[model samples]
Target chain A: MDQGNPLVEETASAVSSLSEEVVRVEGLWKVYGRESKRITSDKYSQMSKDDIRKKTGNIVGLKDVSFSISKGEFFIIMGLSGSGKSTLIRNLIRLIRPTTGRITINGVNITKLSENDLLEFRKKTFGMVFQNYGLLPHLTVLDNAAYGLKVRGLPKGKQYAKAMRFLETVGLSGWEDYYPNELSGGMQQRVGLARALANDPEILLMDEPFSGLDPLIRRQMQDEFIEIQDKLNKTIIFVTHDLSEALKLGDRIAILHDGEIAQIGTPEEIVTVPADSYVQEFVQDASPAKVVTAGSIMVEPEVLLYSWEGPRTALSILKNARRSGAFVVDKKGILLGVTNINRLERIIENPVESQTKRIDASAITKIPSVSEDTILEDLFGIVSANPYPIPVIGENRRLVGVVRTDDIFETISPNRGDQND
Target chain B: MIDFPEIIRIPLRDWIDEIMSWLLNNLETFFDAVGWSILQVMLGFEFVFTHIPWFIFIPLAFLGGWRMLKSLSSGITFALMLFLIGTFGYWEMAMQTLSLVSASVLFSLLIGIPTGILMAQNNRAESIIKPVLDGMQTMPSFVYLIPALMFFGLGRVPSVIATIIYAAPPVIRLTNVGIRTVNPEAVEAAKAFGAKRKQVLWDVQMPLAKPSIMVGVNQTTMMALAMVVIGSMIGAKGLGMEVLLSINRIEVGRGFEAGISIVFLAIIIDRLTFSLSERTSQNNQSHE
Candidate 1:
């Protein structure tokens, strides 16, 4: 009952206030034929697979995608190219109509809108950013930024002011008159960001917007996006092929496989319980403990040992220490230290000061401990912070058998050669 | 020589001569029909041109030049210089050539873009049209006027008809290329945004494809301008006629002036049209 830290309290409040549904898509289907015949069945109607292929002559772009984005959630849809991740977002915008499904946005079926109404819907509702920058090659940055407003018949002066505001926010204030080709890729994406923000959309749709940039710049942009989204709080649907990116940014992520949703959960959920075999392969290569919650690895009560004894006394003092190793807590029973047997080996077998690197009480980043309730992706962030091993917490904030980085990989992907070995 | 004058008046020879006459007449009739179509096009063009105030067209030309060319002042000045040259009585001939070139380019765009669109929509159509367009473009420019004159009898009509074929390839080429090069994702984005089919074509596709379409228009106009002087060789009456008359009469000053006039005309038209098209898609770009 100690609500001590104001910053942590604020974060909890912010997260708790988020609503459950911002976008509800039910049974969404998009079939793109491999051949040239266009798919002509009404996209809103239910159709059998064979019937759709017979009519459209196209391959499946998406197959029965169903998910709802909660407000204040950074929902990432991740897949390799052609996995229909982009198609899912595009269908939400009605940029590509689904072969069949009910896509409800703000409680209205956007699929039923007429052309004029739809244009208005787009103008008023959401903003889009593209990977290519898609900037008009001719216009100055200022003009390009102001394009949507002009197209929507906004008066020149006000649109310019609004564009200028975004230009400043995206850090392109002085270069507003420069053309796109004249700028670097990162700068171009900044302008794209500025343009998307100019409309103050309720939802921001970005399609690999940072994929084309240099790695360093890509990371920098991701950080910048995180900062912006923190303040803007818009429901964002980002599509990317980079797994690391999906883990970093997505509050919840949906893994796509061959036109279907492989798994959808908080990064933690997918990382831990990966819904399908494809998802397993995807997450298997990464260090596993980073993705598994403490609930999965916490030691049983009978196995618990209490003390801050050195690593050398492991055999005599702490029995059933187990291959996973142990965490040391003080008399007050607070987590004070951790040790992994396999990761620790002394130079002359002087095992006391072995590979045990003391993690200061302050050293661990205060992200929540992985729990059954925690998504697998959340553990990844914690594990990534410290590669030695992770401390597992159980009831009464007691030290539990540490989940060795090795054990995590073994749990998620049992097929590999003995991870502990 | 063999005292066979009467003997040589054979029936086979007579029949061969009669056949030659009949074939010649049919050939003449075919040419005549072509010539008449050319005449109608020219007459229609002239009637349209007569309604436009010269002042308005010249200013519009300047506006287009300024729009397309990056250099606005230079474009307007060039447009002004061309107008003055015409007013100093290069006017009639320049207008004559303009009328024909303009008509040819307009029709080429009208015909070529749809053909290009059809081709873009279907590979079979592209396959069929490719060889024909290639042949039409590659045929000798002089060869065009021969058939033109055979039907229209060496007048403006015949010259314009020839010019249309000569100048048309650009519009078709640009239209097809532009439509094809539109970003698939942008179109997909639009569709996902709930954009209708026509909406994808117009808002997402066409706006994205505008720069290419413009390049096509620019090329079409340049080709049309090239053909106009050539058109003048068959009594088309334009700057080409002025250049031709100057050369025939050995008046160097007149020919040189007309040649300069043509260059000025080209610069003006090219710059104006390009700028207009560029301004069409200002916001799509992520960069300045």
Candidate 2:
């Protein structure tokens, strides 16, 4: 993995904590209908969901699904309708019991729990948001947000105080007294989000929470949700059919096909290195320019000019490397500016440089630099207007790599063509 | 087909009669306690409805209509309808009929809602109760009067019992349907939030089902009012008694007066309850 950038390194470190599993599923299978347990054996293992359904009159909702989620990870389960993404999410909370499987949340096997214990476990461990905004039509916004707390038997004053805080977090402070039907679709989902957060459960399950909102509002909500997730660091298992949404919001996405996982990887891997044709086709419509970051495409410069180096040395290094320009950096590799052979040649001819005996500040040209995390779509204007290669800056303005306009164009062209087709 | 049916005939009526006789013989005390409680509730409602002067009742009806329906014209219309009932010379009888209908509806809701909730919660309970509800609804109103009279012995108690049997089906069926059909997403959301089964019922299902349940209540009230005339056949008194007396005496003008008064009362009650249902349902529509 390219852990050259701070953002990627941070995520890489977060992913490294395999020991801190918050939720784990092993061989989970959910078959709907009579004698569902009988179909989980090897006799039906080779058969497809439809074939098994025809044979035993059982609808396979999820088939041998297995995965684990780290704490504070944003895991997305992406699939079309009937692909069992919803079923997987419901099974995580044991809302829909698995026919044959084990689901261990925080090291406790929820599948083995009694009904009463499951209820108590659910109260403490899970908070769910639905696409339909599942707010009670009769309750006010504040009451709806406070519902999870109220159901947990929290005191009225404490419940409202926590609910009020979460309501404000989701930007629904002034709308507390309004009923759900009185709000717009976006505001209703905010209340749904707030209600889930008010519980402060270990896991937040969202089933296409933005699917009901208008497209523009959906984007706005996704942005706000990303910010909120960053702040809260709650483990969220989000289910959505929207591929771009998975790419935009998910730290890692598991694409489900026919009740089984087709592929599970980070968005860049899913986009650039699809595990199979199914995943490739699933990600076919996703625009790479929007998902591919500068760090992934940028090339580390071979010839780097140190600011202490004289203009003669800078020009000689650029010449030997067959490069027209070089990014100028301090000894610590913090990006100062860009310098070219022409500029260095002009500096060597000038007597003003001999007094300092080093490369003059005027020899380096200040051009725009982008963080390694900036997506290619955002780099279009900056890369197009600049004459020099854009420097890829990391944490504390350290120059890690450089992105040429060609890199952006090369990364997006095939994906754009695929989208057009 | 050639007089061969006698051997194949089923003794359903005899069986029912035998069961009825058995119940009447064995459960006398149970029947008496039930009858006495129903009679007390009916008498209490009758006392209040009859004692309130027409002057005070009519204004109160106007105010209730105005507040509930939120229209001055509706208030005036309600007062006018009650005034017409008074002019029909059956004001006290109308109060008696009102009390009977109120008592029947109250007991119907008490029995029907819980039964509905049970049916909503359990598929087996629903399947068992559904056919019984269907029988209660489809059986002729006169069929229950006989059993009710046999059980409670021909008076207001039997009349109220018969009216409850006649009218309770809609509420039971509608309550079952309402709770069962409450938004599944809302129910799922409640469950996901760790709400217990009881919390899911009261917090989400019951509130969402309010409009449908209110409609059921309206239907029950209307059905209960319809039973009043039939209830008179078994020695019950009210506008129904007047109608029964007019029928017995062959007095067409007097029957018409009583019938018109019943119609006036139905119109007022129906409008009020219908508006109540409408208001509840309208509260759920998107104001945005």
Candidate 3:
């Protein structure tokens, strides 16, 4: 739903203007130890986390981290363990206090809030899904899901009603009476998700929520989470160590490395134009076919035949361009069909001027066309099956451009070469 | 063997005696209040246990065992054990002993659980309390009697105090361990959902730590029962006094019957508590 030209900076700027800023974190640092304050200084900040730890006995959890999340955006903070991804997410909710800098959410500076106020702020602001599921073992599924509401001092009837609604949303309707341990890992996480969702907070902060599940279940949960997010339209800040998960679910991913951000970009930008060698190496294995869209690769055709044009005129245009086939469009550029040179020649040789007032219906061959936003991965079968270049259609069935098989191959070949090495 | 140097020997014994005397003099009113409250609670339990007809008590206890253990055989066995104690002609003494054990355990849990929570919450508290808990467990049960006597004088009050000192460590230690070892992710989840510190403790940590804490209670009860004979030396009444009297009179049959009654009581108490802990832990076993 957030489709745009990955290579274009203007589209990204336009998106920022369109969406409201919900969470802004600036120059945030989390240094762990008694002398954590020392590590925030410019001299110690320049050093790596390990080097700083060795010199001052203070471990750096995050260093000068800064990012802002827009409303309804699925923003991902991704890195391996010890990369401060978890720290960043925790810092957002102030579960782990930042040593220095500020976090302003919905225009209020949360870093300055007292502990009492922070607790009250968190209740209305964030719904968190933990990696370990974090369902209370003693509580039944319905009760666990209702824990947030219960803590907020909601009445028993209201709590259960809200919790049951979320449980149904997560497909756990019959499991209300069962304890968390009675369910499998995936179901337990579903309870975790339901608990978070029951609160109906402004943002969903997920910390590798599906990493504990089996791969198949993880994928299923990811898809279901996407559907849920689409329906709810809540801002989500997802943290994960898995690159592909980030690429799949994130509207934009911030790649963190050793307490620093390496890059922040859309999946296509990360794959196609990495910020540095670190980002390039991180995305090296990612198949561009999955991220690159037909719209980005499709080129303007050399020749086109309007439905109003005669076969003689179409033949001359085809002859000038030296092409076997040409796509035909209406006056407003809506794709009608394609006609090759042979079909044009036959129509002209018959000289059916009376019957063929316009281009004959029999002369045109209608082939399958794809929308511009269709990813390259889906185009492989269609591209290989058709002899002619695929027409890239846009809104209202307007023919935007054509994507040749060579374009798909060119977009994917670099990744294939990397994989071989 | 070389003789130890006299100059190097510390006056730790004198220092402790001085401290004990000072507490006896200065905290006499505080000790009296604590002693009176403990005596009243013990008497309340004694009155209830002694007043209930053996017929009604045995059947009720059997029903409790049956419900708690989910087994009719366990209930029947526990009921039979109570009957065996009566046959031994020490049913009255056994009731008195049960009251004392119950009172000691109630106080132990009241104090120990909170202490354990404090220890779990703060590293400094844990470090400070851990060694004291170790001393309570490892010290000879006889040594607690001296302080008990100094604070409450010779009576059931002193015996109750001594029994608590001897019995409270396991519950305190285990409660601390239980709360400390509760799944951290669960606590974090509670906090993330904006649960206050108090809510996190009662709603999350305490319930999750229950099985371990129940085990602690079981151990404390067993230890309190073990203190009965020792408690009788300080003028406490029960099957323990009967055993002490038999020991003094050199009557083997009387001592044997009293000892058998104590054994039966221990067995019945142990099984009921063990079953309770088992029930609490059942949630962990996977049904699938």
Off by over 4 Å in 2: A1-12, A15-19, A320-322, A415-421, B1-4, B286-288
The DockQ-based order of candidates, best leading, equals 2, 3, 1
- Output DockQ, candidate 1: 0.14
lDDT of 2 by residue, A281-336 (tens): 88877789878988888998877888888788888898998999988999788888
Local error of candidate 3 at residue B155 (angstroms): 2.1
Stretches off by above 4 angstroms in model 1 are A1-18, A33-58, A289-421, B1-154, B184-234, B237-288
Q: Each model's C-alpha lDDT?
A: 0.70, 0.88, 0.88
Using DockQ as the yardstick, the better of models 1 and 2 is 2
The local lDDT score (0 to 100) that residue B216 gets in candidate 3 is 97
Per-residue C-alpha lDDT of model 1 across residues B1-288, encoded as one tens digit per residue: 757588556598689667656755778777677566656776677777656777877787666556556667865796687777766577666666667877777777878878877776678888898888898899998876775665566777777678778777777877777878776655544443445566556665666677777788888888889877678888888788888888899999878899888887777777666666666656445432
lDDT of 3 by residue, A257-343 (tens): 999998998889888889989898899889998888888999998788898887878888889888898899988998888999998
Model 1 residue A233 CA deviation in Å: 1.6
List pairs with backbone clashes in candidate 2: none
Tens digits of lDDT, candidate 1, A54-133:
66656677877889887767889899987888788888887777777789888878888876788888877888888787
- Clashing pairs for model 3 are none
Worst 10 residues of 2 chain A by lDDT: A1-10
Q: After superposition, how far is residue A196 of candidate 1 from its true place, in Å?
A: 1.5
